[model samples]
Target: MEEESQIVFILFAGAFLAALMATFVVAMVILHRQRQVQNKQKMEQLQLEHERTLLNIENEIQQETMSHIGRELHDNIGQLLSLSKLYLGSSKPEKQAEGRELITKVISEVRGLSKTLNLDWVESISIREFAKQQLDRIQATGFCQTELDQEGDPWELEKNQKLVFIRVIQECLNNAIKHASPNHVSIQIIKNESGRKIIIKDDGKGFDTTIPSKGSGMTNLKKRMETIGGEFLIHSSLGNGTEIKLLLPN
Candidate 1:
């Protein structure tokens, strides 16, 4: 009878051990599944965020383009139309001569505006030189003093990428002038194995980034950078200066 009891006890112990091991295996499987689900969720979230950023950027670009068109229409086209009307209505010889001169001036202005709006030459121009021209124009406006620096042999980047960089820099300059009230702005472009680097710094009053304003300009800039597989970093604090850095792969 004792021998029988010992055998039964051993059998029960073995069964218990088996059950314990099975439970452990099941638990590990559950944990692994949960981890996978969490990672998937994180990936989906990131994708959604990226899409939203892109949409915002496209909207901003459209808005900017429309704004430029409107300005040109109002300032150049409207003036020309007005002058043409004046010349047509005038009956006096002296007034007709004045109208003719005015028309000539309007024609010249239209030609200049056309040149400004043309994008055909962008492909032929170097980005560094283009940036320098932009800076010179901005300085001529007397809003702010701007400077540009470059390092390394400038690569021929995609046209859209070049335009995006130009727009982002222009946006930064505009922000510094209107909001930051900066006296000076500096831009630096560099190329390395990692990619193209753009740095825009301004000595102006900066705002808290944690409470970022949903400015169209900023949103568009972030979107453009993301679309190009680039990254942007903004460093600023209230009463301090602002620095924006962008990195784009070669």
Candidate 2:
């Protein structure tokens, strides 16, 4: 009878151990599933945050572009139109005819500028080709003798990056024309160790870049460069020429 009792005890112990092992296995499975779920949630959250950041950056760039375009239209183009109208309303017939012709020319220019302001240009043109065209246009304006140089084989940049580059260059050109009155401008695009580099230099009357109150255009250019994970450095003085170096990472 004691032997039977011992056997019965052993059986019960074995059963208990089996049950415990089963429970451990079940707990491990549950924990693994929960970990996988948590990991997936974290990944999803990261992706969403990345997307939101991109959208915000894009919106900011768009706002800046529109603001600049609006200012150009309202301040420059609008003033020109108004002046032409004033001239048209003059009593002299010769003045009226001259005003009408000037109005026509101004309208044509506005249309051209408006077309450029559209984002379609960014989508349609290759960056290399676009850069070349812009350089030509700047030279045609007779504001400066512009030169473009490319070091490596041309590679297409991301859309937003291209736009940022174009706008920054445009701002620089405009500043050179308006403030520096440069006779010669040189633009160079070269492949650096990590990515791309742009250097724009002009033989013009430079300014004290140490002062923070230079202009909104320069500030805006810096911000645009930062947005694209780039760096901008300006070197200038009172009589010396100005040079701008912009670096963009791969």
Candidate 3:
């Protein structure tokens, strides 16, 4: 009976160990599942934040465009209309040629604005084509000469990614106009299996990279690229020029 009791104790110990091991495995599985759900939630949250940033940037660009339109109206088109009216009302016989010239100029300005300056609609276009149009607008100012080139197979990006790209390029163009005062701006898009790279170069009065500007928008530019899973790089000197590079992941 003592021997039988010893065998029973051994069996009990083995069963207890098996039960403990099973409990440990079940706990580990539950922990792993919880961690996976938490990770997925965090990823979703990050994507939402990035999307918000891109939308904000796009809104800012649209607002800036409206401001440009306002300036053109107040300074150029408005003034031209006023001058045309004054010329038309003149009773002096010698002012016929001048009046005709002013009227012609007014017609030309209206046609250009109606046919060309429309920049609001961008539903079906690719970002590359959109970028080309923006650079063309910059060049149309006559103060800047711009060139755009594309290489390799074009790729499509997510909507948020496209918006971020458009806004970033818009910002770069504005900065080159305002700060660098570049005479010639060159944009190139290079694509590969890995990803796409956009290079925007300007032959302008470049600034010293080491010196900090009070309110330069470089911070926003960097943040914009980071939100889109890309990279932004700038190279410039006091006299040489400025070159901006953006890289998108594969």
Candidate 4:
């Protein structure tokens, strides 16, 4: 009986030690996993901050260029056109007609360029307005019918997001026009519970993209969206249309 009891006690002690070691290993795994998650989050935040800094510098350079061009259009080229207009108005009928035509052409070009002169204009406008401009450009091409529709109330976005969003939309539009050759392109901005959704759909001659055939441009688009806390998705098949979606968290 004494020997049997000693044996039982030995087994019990061994079992308890095994159980303790198992618990410690589990705890260590959980702690390690938590640290990894925290590290990933910190890295993502740092990357976003870096992107914002680069984008700000880019915008500053673009703004400076716009200012210089604006002044040139308003002061130099604008003055030349005004003087020609006056000179033509005072000349004989034949010369006056020619000068009037020349002046009219200059006026039209200047008017068109003036719209592009506002340095801070792109960052100041709402997304809908920016989308309209892109659609209008597509419309001007006469290659496709462009339309934009909104769902839910408009959402406010920061300067960096706005810049990235506009560029991403432009990229999608360019891809649609260049590759898809679509007859119609539509954009929709819907505000949902998860976030804001921007859908770019085209009734173009889509191709097979099932094998992850997107080039660097598309990859860049994905990275940019991820940086802005948004997701990019693309769906397309042979002989069908292409659809691209951008989702931003609320």
Clashes of each: 0, 0, 0, 0
Which parts of model 1 have CA positions greater than 4 angstroms off?
84-137, 155-170, 203-242, 248-250
- Model with the higher lDDT, candidate 1 or 2: 2
User: For candidate 3, lDDT tens digit of each residue in 1-250?
Assistant: 9999999999999999999999999999999999999999999999888778866876776776677667777989898778777777889755666778877887887665554344444445687798888888887778788898999987687767777788888888878888887779989998988889999999889988888878848877888899978999999998888999999979
On residues 1-250, what C-alpha lDDT tens digit does candidate 2 reach at each position? 9999999999999999999999999999999999999999998987675455455555654666687678878977788788889889999999899889878988787777776565665777765676677678788767678888889867568876777777677777767877888888888888856898889899999988778874476776787787678888899999998999989988
Runs in model 2 deviating more than 4 A are: 1-117
Number of the top-ranking candidate, with TM-score as the measure: 3
Error of 3 at 162 (Å): 2.7
lDDT of each: 0.78, 0.79, 0.82, 0.82
Cα TM-score per model: 0.65, 0.55, 0.72, 0.65
| lDDT of candidate 1 over 1-250, digit per residue (tens) | 9999999999999999999999999999999999999999998998887666545544565666567667877976788778777876888888788777877877886776565454555567677886787678678778788899999887678766666666677677778878988878888989988888988888899989889587566766777687668887899999888999988887
lDDT measured at residue 221 in model 2 versus the true structure, 0 to 100:
74
Per-residue lDDT of model 4, residues 7-87, tens digit only: 999999999999999999999999999999999999999887767745754575476557657776797678768767776
Candidate 3 local Cα displacement, residue 95, angstroms: 8.7
Off by over 4 Å in 4: 1-45, 52-119
Model 3 regions lying over 4 Å from their true place: 87-120, 124-145, 153-158, 178-183, 203-219, 236-240
lDDT of 2: 0.79
